[model samples]
Structure formats: C-alpha cells, structure tokens
Target: MTPTRRGPKKIDYVGAQSDGTKLAADLPAAVQVPDDAVAWTAVLGESTVRNLHSPDWKTREHALQAVMRSLGNARWNAERSPEDVWNTVTQLLDKALKDKVAPLYYASLELLSTLVATYSPNLPYGVLTQGLEPLMPTLLHRVGNNNARIQETSIQALLTLANQPALGLAFLAPHALSAIPKKSQSGAAAAIQMSGRLELITCMLNVQVQQQMGFGTAGRTPAAAAAAGKGGDALMAEDVVRFTRPALDMPDDKVRTAAVRLVAEVYRTRKAAGQPFEVEKMVGAGLKPALMQRLA
Candidate 1:
C-alpha cells in the first residue's frame, strides 16, 4: 500500500537565543516607573505644547513632531493618560488647524492620525469619543480647503477615525457628513457675506474601514460595511460631506476641471443621500459653469 503523505506540522513562532532556548518577554509584575520620570514626562508634554504655539514656523513644526513622538512612546504614554495630554494640547491643536501656514496644518493633522494609529491600544478607549469625535466638525470643514496639505491631512485624519471599531462605525462615517453653503458675498462697495470656497475634493474613500480588535469594539452598519468592502472603488457618495462653495478660481483649466469633476461627483452623491446642497445656487460656483458649458 502507498503511504499517505502528510504536510509538515506548524510550530509556534518563538525567538531563540544562541543557546537554543526560547526567549521570553522580560516584563515585571507591574510597571514601576519612578516619580521623577512621570513628572519629567509631564513637563516634556507641556514644553512641546508651548513650542507648538511659537511664532516661528520651525518651532511650531518641531513641537508638533515632538508631541507626535511623545504620544507614541509606550513608557511616556503610561505616565500620562492620552486624554489628559489631549486636553492640555486641544487649544494648540485648534491653533494649528486654523493657522494658514501649510506645514503647521499638515503637522497637526499628522499628529492626530499618528496618535490613533500608534497609541490606540495603549491609550484609553474614551479618546475616540472624548478626544476625537469633538474634532470632527473642524476636520470636515477643512476638507474643503484648497490647500493640498490641509485637504490631504483632513482626509487622513478622517480615515484614521474610521478605522476605530471601538468608536463604532458611526464614529466617522456617512451618517456624520453635513454642512451648509457659505452665503454669497458682494463687492468692495458692499459687505462680503461669505467669500471663501474650495478647490479641494481629495477622497471619500475610507481606507481605515478596518476590523475592530480592541477594548471598546464598534462595527459599521450593514450598508456601511457592504460599501466598505468595495474598498477604494466604493462610490465617493458612500461618504458625503456638504460643500459650502466651489474651488475653481485657479488659473489652470485642467485644475479647475478636476475640481469640477470632484464637485459633480459629490453633488450627485449628496443628492442621492438626500442631504442639503446649495452649490448650484451660487453664481460663481465652479461646478455650475463647468457642467453648463460642457452641456452647451
């Protein structure tokens, strides 16, 4: 009789020492960091926040980087809760977001995304609701800014929130997308109501539609989960954000046209979702003329 072949057995992955002994983690029964270490970490966190508000862009950028690093460190984070750190830095974060300087905005966005990505497990679960959800409106508003750094970082920050199953699928998903159009403004002889618009439509794709493997588990609705399964191909409408105005003042027709396409896609999706849209009401709205001229 022919002998049946068997596949090799799988073994548990273990690091081996030079002596061929399996290595084990050298963890103490409990972390016993000294009082001075904790106090110093708190000081470092405070100093970093101070640097973020410095007048010099270099100083601001360096501070943001420092905050990002300190938040990501395991021992440092253990010393100070993420919520405490975030509360202390909230004002600085707000300033960074509002700063017209591209680098400051980019660093702020990166800092938020980096924290969720790096410290999700080590930090408390409340950061999602307490630390992140409160910042959603500001993040959504910035998504419409024409500046590349602001736009991309906004998208990245949103995606990071979407990845958290602990916060539930609705933490940062389609259910949360909504905004009112900025009222039209007049000329130099008249008061301007609202002049700012957008040239930005980065992506509605939520790459962070990932699985929940943490403490406070949160999952998406069936529809949201189904849409997420399609990944990048998910219709941009799957995650809609109301646009207050168009971003088409750019001289380059190619750029304007691209912006128009983004707006058209967004408008179509927004309508399908039954959300309010006033871009068509604005005469200078970039999406309007682009669509009309093409039809004519």
Candidate 2:
C-alpha cells in the first residue's frame, strides 16, 4: 500500500522560533474572533493584557489587534460605565504608543482611533476626558516620531479623538500649544519632526473650524441661532498664532513652510467662522513679511 501523504502543518498561532527571528505572520484563524456583541471584559482578559506588554513585538502587535477588533465589533452603551475598561485600555495603549517598533506604534494608533470612534458618541464626556488626559501628551509627542507612518497615524488618532464632543479645543489646545520644538533643540531630524507637529496642529484647528461653521461630518448648514449653540470652548486664534510665531523664523524651509500653512489655516478658519479676533494683527507686522517671503 502506498504511504499516506500529508501536507505541511499549518500555523494556527505564532510561536517562538529557534533562531529568535520574528515570524512575519498574522494571528491564526483559530483565535477567537469577537462578534458584534462581545463585551469589553472578555476582550481585556488577563492574558491579553499581559501580552500587550510582551517583550516580543509580534505578541504586542497581536494583542493590539485583539483589542481593536473587540472595540470595532462590540456594541457600545452610553449608560454602561466604562471607567474600569477605559483605564485598563488607556494604560496599555499609552505604553504601546511609546513603543519603538514602527508597526506596533502604528497599531497602537489604529487601536486608539478605533476606540474613540466607537465610544465617543455613547460615552460620557468626563469619562472619556479622564481616560485620554495622559494620552494626549504622549500622542502629541509621537506626532514627531521619526517614522513617517507613525507620524501620520499619530496625527490621525489625535484628530479622531479631538473631533468628538467628548474631546475638543478645551482638551487639545494646550497640548498643541506646548509641543513646539525649540529652534536650538531641532537638528536635521528634529526639523522634520517639527514639521509633523505643525501639520497635526493645523489639521486639528481645521476640524474645529469646520464644526464651528456648521459644516460637520454631515455637511448640513445649521441656522444661525443653532450654529452659536454648538457648545464647547472655541480655540483662541491668538494663541495659535503666537504658538506658530517661532516656526516662522526657523531657517529650515520645511519647518517654515509647515508654519506658514498653519498660520494660513488659522487665518482661513477665523475668516470662515467670522471670528472677531484679528489673527494677522495678533502676529503684528511680521506676519505679512513671513507670508510674502514664503510666497515669493
């Protein structure tokens, strides 16, 4: 009788290799996939939380995926208190955001973006604010990460969180205002990082501008009375202009260009919102020359 033939064994899960080289594989199909009704408690199990901080990058990446998948699939409830879950997830993600590995960093940002998108509408404002307070600073710092993908992901994550009612100008403005790099501190690499930070701040301000003008995600213009009723602390145009003033003087063209874009966006946002503050006047005579030099 001919010997029975068998194919190579399939990997249902990733395991450590003998040579210590990381395996480039996705989590196995056998892994439990969370359904639409999965609870946060089940997803944030002990082992899963532990793996999120594992020494192995792949393990951490897989843990991020599990968390993200659960959030994406789970049914969120505004009435259900999410403090415990929020704290646990926030702590893990904070570490993950600081992860040196590029893939893990991006994954962390994706997970964060998912969490904010899923729960912002349902969760209480104070609860979300409490959870994200520590995170916002870390995120602002990560916006300057060396990896381009990480920078972009970090920016997107910040905007996703900020655009929601739970987090707006009141929460984000201070962090953005403080993240500017000193001219002496920014070297060749730092210049690029500075540009990333400027870009992110510009995007965030633009989101606020859109909302203030009643051009929200739905893009329906509300009545004048209702437009002013959109509650939250409006971002001070003067503060942002002052924040970017240093960037206007930086010798690096990229940094200067980003700064110019930021200032321009600030002016445009004010114009669109019909805000009373004169941003150009706020920056004094220097604003025009800076704009002209760049335009020239």
Candidate 3:
C-alpha cells in the first residue's frame, strides 16, 4: 500500500481574507502613458477606490499602483473642481499609508510623493495645504521605519514636497520640530529618529534657501516668485533660531552634526542672497553658547 499522504497544513494570514480575489490588471507605468491620453476620473474610478479599501492585500496594492501610474495623466487641469477630487483621494491615502503590508505601505508613500510633485504647483493654496499638511507627521515618523529602503523613500517624498513652490519650508518646519523630543532619551532608536528629523530640517532649509535665491522658480513670474521667496525666508529664519539651539544638545553625534551643518548653511545662504544675518541678534545668546559647547 502506498504511504498515507499528508495534506499541507492550513495557515491563516490575519487581515488577508479573500486573498485570492481577482482584480484588474496593473496599470502601465506612468512614463509609458502618453501625456495627454488619460483623465484622472478614468484612472481613479469607483471600482479602484473600492479596491483600495479591500481586505485583500493584493487588491489594495494593485489599486494604489493604478493610482500612482495614472497620476501624471493630462486631464487633472480640466477637472471642474480639483479640491473635491483632492480631498477624496487624500482621505483614501491617509488610510493606505497606515497599511501593515510592506508593499502597500511603500506604494502609498510613492503615490504621495507623486501627488505632491504633480499637483503642488497647480492646486489652490487652501486645497494644497488642507490636503497635504496633515500627512507631514506620518511622513516624518516613517523616517524611522525599520526598512532602510522605506526610510530613504520617505525622505525622498519629504524632499519632493519641500522643493515644491506651493508648500514652502515653513510648512514642514513645525512637523520636523515637533517630531523631535524636548528631552533627550537614552535609546539608540530615539537617537536615530532625532537624527533623521534634524537632517530633514536641514534639507528643508536648503531647499528654501535655493528657492529664495531664485534657483528653482520655473513657472512663476519674477515678481510673484520674489514675493513668495521673501515670505519663506522670514519664516525659515524664525525656525532656525527656534530649533537649532536645542538640536545641538542632543545626545547623538549625527544629530549634532546635522544641527551644525544647518547653522552653517543658513549663514552661507544669507551671505549668497546678500542678506545680512546678524547671528547674535537673530539666534540670540542661546545658540552661541550651544555652538561653543559643541566645539569644546
């Protein structure tokens, strides 16, 4: 008699019910699609939105992929009211960003990066701030994600958002400052998060300085661009004085180094812009002491 055959043991994955549900094929890469060919409505229909909330990971994953691929399509400009569409999709994105599955989480972040890169310039100020500002904390915290690639991707997303003219350095400064702790903690993980936040603040300031100096103004009229740059410069100067002093006292070497680099960059940017930065007056007595302590 043949030996009794054993069936494979059954194992259940939590939250992955209907895992075999068939979904539409993945959309083509965004670059493959002709610029003027597709509209936002066709790409993000009712079915795709429904799939994003599906219990099956693959369905949600595919839905996000479709949105990301079709995000750059040409018809966003023709929509009657983009605020309505932005609000709908951003709410979906908030949920998707918290997805437990790795692929889905990364896909959500990638979509966010694309969303900011593509729409920041075109969306109305109220709409852009309302839609994207709330996501800043999530992106900042994700910098400490265990996956290295995810960390890098999150930083790239933040940088992309920062570089946009619609949202200036001031918008991200509050989130970055709030993410770092007031009191230093005694763990490696805390240090890493602190370092990431500090580095992010530095990058944001660098982007702002570039903007204020007329480096990346592609579409705005010269007068409008100069006005926007001045607003950003004033806000950024305040933030530098607010945070750099405490950042220098952080326990991590990397965090301290980032703080020092941020200060140096501020001086360099102010000099290049032909703006006088009276460091003693702007940063006050506190920062000088902190810098002196760090040097010692």
Which number leads on lDDT? 2
* Candidate 1 per-residue C-alpha lDDT over 137-234 given as tens digits, one digit per residue, 9 for 90 to 100: 56665554444555566666765666554433444544233432232222321111111112222333223222322233333434434434533223
Q: In candidate 2, what are the lDDT values of residues 1-296, reduced to their tens digit?
A: 99998532211111212111122123343333223213434537756754654556688789889878766553633333466556657766655665656677677778887777776666665676677876776676667766676678778877776665555555566677774544425577567657777887788777766776666642111321133243353456777777778777778887888887877777666666677545456666664564655433
Mark the regions of model 2 whose C-alpha exceeds 4 Å error after superposition: 1-43, 72-81, 181-184, 217-233, 272-280, 285-296
* Predicted structure 3: lDDT: 0.61
lDDT score for candidate 1 against the true structure = 0.47
Which sequence of candidate numbers ranks them by lDDT, best first? Answer: 2, 3, 1
**Model 3 misplacement above 4 A:** 1-43, 74-81, 179-186, 218-235, 271-296
Q: What are the TM-scores, per candidate, against the unseen true structure?
A: 0.50, 0.70, 0.69
In model 2, the Cα lDDT at residue 83 comes to: 65
Least well predicted 10-residue stretch by lDDT in candidate 3? 8-17
Q: Model 3 over residues 130-201: C-alpha lDDT tens digits?
A: 887667656776675545676777787877765666665545555666635433245676666666666666
lDDT of each: 0.47, 0.62, 0.61
